[model samples]
Target chain A: MVNEVIDINEAVRAYIAQIEGLRAEIGRLDATIATLRQSLATLKSLKTLGEGKTVLVPVGSIAQVEMKVEKMDKVVVSVGQNISAELEYEEALKYIEDEIKKLLTFRLVLEQAIAELYAKIEDLIAEAQQTSEEEKAEEEENEEKAE
Target chain B: MELPPQIQAQLMQLQQLQQQLQMILMQKQSVETELKECKKALEELEKSSSDEVYKLVGGLFVKRKKEDVKKELEEKVETLELRVKTLEKQEEKLQSRLKELQEKIQKMIPTAQ
Candidate 1:
């Protein structure tokens, strides 16, 4: 009986460790989602900017170059696999919007996962408490019998 | 000197759940890291003012048009986003199973004060 209780205690400890790790992962995901949302907003604003406007473009970490938009109608877009094509401004905006939709969907999925993890962790905590109580009761009963 | 069969089974289930949770957490960490990198790349691309951009293809930087680089970054971000979604779905399923197993054990074990 003592051995069995020890095993259960070990299992409970393992479960607690796993739960902590998962909680950390959820926190990281929250930060990632926030960053992605910010990036999406920036892209949307870029789409709305007027075509014939001067913009400061970063050349490097410390250098910024000012350039006037000459061809707002035709913008180059990467097709995939390192291939790019010239696309109209509206088309590029549409493409970006689609990407943003995908990101939002992904974020919803992540939120669902975190919720499920929390539920599981709650159940585990309850189970651990029950196991510990059982172990204590068994030990007390043994001591009483000896007395 | 043997544990009750029921108690042994409960321990096994708990161990399995712990392992599953560890695996899911690892996958989530990797996906989150990849997503961060994709977002950073997109931001850098957006800030560039030059028409010419260099794209990393097969471990080499190839000259590409700025709009094309932006599009590529967008595509990468989309792909990573989809990957994260799939991993999250898997995590949800695993957690549900773990919860079910835990509840079953709780019911089987007699409550002690």
Candidate 2:
């Protein structure tokens, strides 16, 4: 009867490690979200050089921004609520921040739950192990009595 | 003539528990794979769309023909952008599915001692 298919100890230990890794991932996501939010706040803080709206800016709201960043060469930064959703970069950064925040929050709750599950699984495994050991002891005692 | 029947029942229960765990695990794996694929597709779509935008509206060339090229690029970028938007929506849907599958796995966890 003691086939030992689900070695609860090992399984529960694996589960604990899994939950810990998940927690770390969530923390990483939280950091990323914070960083993106900072970038957006920086974008919002950018000084507008002011240009007439002749589609003067692609997406038109960015006006103009000058820099030597080289990475963002030929690019402009726009402000205003409506402008946030139009440009791909602007929209992507903004939404990715939001997604990471959500993912972090969800992961936090899930890890807590998974941790509880692992604790329970550990308990079950221990109980099963003990029960098997006791059964063997009983069988030995009975043999001694029979002899 | 035999040992207790409870042992048999316990054995059966444990087996059932093991099967249940396996089923849940399989579901988790499937959902994880789907999520990974969805994200990969979305990333590729986003990259291609960004490249399109850059090609079309990339410069501030003063020549009239250059301006026309820019205008055409912008229009193409706009249409490609809608595809990206659709992909975003699909991504969000998959994200929600991921959450549901995770919760289902949580629920499938067997009882502790």
- Top lDDT prediction, candidate number: 1
What is candidate 2's lDDT per residue for B16-102, written digit by digit as tens?
Answer: 655655555565555555544444433333332232221212443222232343454345555555655555565565556555655
| Predicted structure with the largest DockQ when compared to the true one | 1
TM-score of 1: 0.46
Runs with alpha carbons beyond 4 Å of true place in candidate 2? A1-6, A44-97, A125-147, B1-52, B55-113
Where in model 1 is the C-alpha error above 4 Å?
Answer: A1-52, B1-113
Residue-level lDDT for B27 in candidate 2: 57
User: Candidate 1 on B1-113: residue-level lDDT in tens?
Assistant: 56568867887988987798788789888878877866765664564445776665786667877776677677877987888888788888888988888887777666421
TM-score of the B chain in each candidate versus the native B chain: 0.78, 0.42
Q: Report the CAPRI category for model 2.
A: incorrect
Interface RMSD of each: 8.7, 10.9
Query: Could you estimate the TM-score for every candidate?
Result: 0.46, 0.36
